[model samples]
Target: MKYFIITGTSRGLGEAMAFKLISPEHQLICISRTKNNDLIAASSHLDYYEFDLQNVNQIEALMEQVFQKINLTNADGVYLINNAAIISPFSRIEQANSQDLMDNLHVNLLAPIVLTSSFIRLTQHLPLEKRILNISSASAKQLLPGMSAYSAAKAGLDAFSSCVGLEQGVESAAVKIVSVYPGMVDTSLQEQARNTSNEALTTPDIFKMVKDRGMLASPAATADKLISFLLGHSFHQGAVVEDLFL
Candidate 1:
C-alpha cells in the first residue's frame, strides 16, 4: 500500500490524478482550495482537505492535521504530487499586478517548497521511499509571451527541484524530486486560458502541438505513467526525472 498526497485536487489534472489513483489498496490525501463532493464520495480510502494554496501561513498547521488524520509517521513511504497551480488570465507579465505574481508564486512555487520541507522533516527517519513530483509546463523552457510570470515561476520550481534532488542525494535520503511536464491535457485551466485574453493567446495549432508533439499527454495517460514510476522499482536518492514526451 502507498500513501499519496496530491494538491490542487479540486479540478484539472489534480482531479484526474486523484480519481485514477484511487483504489482499495492505496491511501489518498487530496488537498485543494475547495472540496469536490464527487471525489469525496467516490473512495473510502480518500481524505480531503480544503486549503488555499495562496495562504502560505496555514500550510504547517494543515500538514499537521493531515499527518494526524492519516496517522502517518516516518515509517510510511509517502508520495507527494505538487500539482496545484495558477495559470493564464493572470498569465501575462505586463498585464499582471504585483499581487497576481505573488499569488502565482505562493501557490505554484512557495507552497510546494514549504510542503516538501515539512515532508522531509517528517520522513527523515522513515525507512520507506519518499518522492516529490512537481507538475511543470513547457512554458518553463522558453519565453511564453503572455505567460511570462507563470513560466518564470515554473522555471524557478524546476530549478528548485533539481537542487533539492542533488542535496537530498548527498544526504542519502530516499527522497526523489521529479519535475514532470504533463503536456496539454484537456482541462478547464486550458479552456480558461483560451477565453481569458484575445491578445497573445495560444492558437489552437499551438495547443495541438503541445498535445500531440510536446508533453501534453492525456491526464489519464500521465497519471498512469506517474503511478508506474511511483509504485514500481525504487530509484536512487535525488533523481530528477521528466516524463518522456514520446
Candidate 2:
C-alpha cells in the first residue's frame, strides 16, 4: 500500500487529486482548514484533518497523529503533497500589509519547509520510495506587479526544494523532491486575483483575458496531468520545473 499525505484537500486541485487517488491500494491522509463532507462520504480509505496550515508550530504533532494511521512496515511508498497556499493582499511591496505578508509566507513557504523536514526526519530509515511534490505557480518567476510577497514565497520554496534535493542525493535512502508549476487553473486564487482592485494588481486584465479566452485549465484536468507526471517514470528529483511536464 502507498500512503499519501496531502494538504489543502478541501477544494480545487487538492480536492481533485484526493478524489483521484482514492483506492483500496492507497490510503489518503488529507489536511486542510475545513473538511469536505462529500470527500469524507466518498471513501473510508481517507483520513481527514480539519486543521489549518497557518499553525505551523503544531504541524509536527499533527504529522505524528497522521502517521499513526499508516502501517509503515507494509507500505511501499509514502508521498507528501504540499499543495496548500494563499495568494492575497495583492499589493505593491510599499503598500503590502505586514500581517498579510507574514501569513502568506507562513502558509506558502514556512509550512511546506517544516513539513518536508518533518517527513524526511521521520522516514529517514524507511526503505520505501519517498517523494515530495510542491505545488508552485508561474508567479514565482514572472515579474507581476502587486505580487511581491506571493512571488517571494514561491521563489524561496523553489530554492529550498533544490537545496533539500541536494541534501538527499548523498543519503543511503534518498527522498525525491520536485517543485512544479501547475500552470493556470481556475481556482479560488484566480478568482481572488480577478476581483482585486486595479490599484492592487496592475495587470488585472491578464486574469480577465485568460478567462475570456477560455484558457484557464480545469482543476480536475490539471490534477490528472500533475498526478500522472508525479507517479510516472518521467519524474525527476530536484528539478525546478516551469511546466507541468505536459
Candidate 3:
C-alpha cells in the first residue's frame, strides 16, 4: 500500500489533496493545525494529527511518532506534501513585525525543511520510493509589495528543493522532489484579496484579477492536477513547475 504524509490538511488545497489521496489501497497521515472530523469520516485510510505548523520546533518528534506506524519494508512508496501556509499581516519588509516574520518562516519554510530531513533520515536504508512535493506560489517569483515574508519563504523553499535535487542527482535511489506552483486557486487568497485593504497590497489590482475577473482556479481541480503529476511520471530531479495549460 502507498503512504502519503500531508501537512495543512485541515483546510484549503491541503484538505482537497488529502481527500483525493484517500483510498482503501493507501494510508494518509495528516499533520495539520486542527482535526478534520469530516475528512476522518470519509475514509478509514485517514489518520489525523493536529499540531500547528507555527510550532515548527516540535514537528520532528511528532514525525518520529507518525513514522512508527508505517512499516517501510511493506510499503510500495511514500510521499510527503508540504502544503500548509498563510499570508497574513501583509506589510512591507521594513514594517514587518518580528513575531509574524518568525511565524511565517516557521510555517511556510522551516517546517517543510525539518520534515523533509526527518523523512530522509528515517527512511534512509529502506528500499521504498520517496517523493516530496512542496506547494509553491507565484508570489515566490512575482513582485507583490506587501508579501515580503510569504515571497521569501517560498523562494527559499524553491532554492532548497533545487539544491536537494542537485545533491540527489548522482546518488542511487534518492528521493524525488518538486516545487509546484498550483496557479491561483480559490483558496484563502480570494478572501484576502477581497477583504484586505488596497493600501496594504503593493499590487491592489491583483485582488480584482483573482476574484472580479473570475481567474481563480478551483482547489479540487488543482488537487487533481497535482495528484496526476505525482502519479503519472517519475520525477528525476527537483523542479519548479506549474500546472500545464491543457
> Pick by lDDT: which candidate is best?
2
Write candidate 1's Cα lDDT for 213-244 as tens digits: 55445677767776666566643345445444
The TM-scores of all predictions, comma-separated, are: 0.87, 0.97, 0.94
Model 3, 78-118: lDDT tens digits are: 99999988886577777788988899899999999999888
Candidate 2: 10-residue stretch with minimal lDDT: 197-206
Query: Could you tell me how far off, in angstroms, the CA of residue 4 lies in candidate 2 after the best superposition?
Result: 0.5
Most accurate candidate by TM-score: 2
Q: lDDT of each prediction vs. the true structure?
A: 0.76, 0.89, 0.84
Pairs with steric clashes in candidate 3: none
The superposed Cα distance between candidate 2 and the true structure at residue 206, in angstroms, equals 0.8
Clashes of each: 3, 0, 0
**What are the per-residue Cα lDDT tens digits for candidate 2 across 89-156?**
68888787788889999999999999999999888889998999999888899968878889999999
TM-score, candidate 3, is 0.94
Which pairs, if any, clash in model 1? Answer: 183-215, 183-216, 184-216
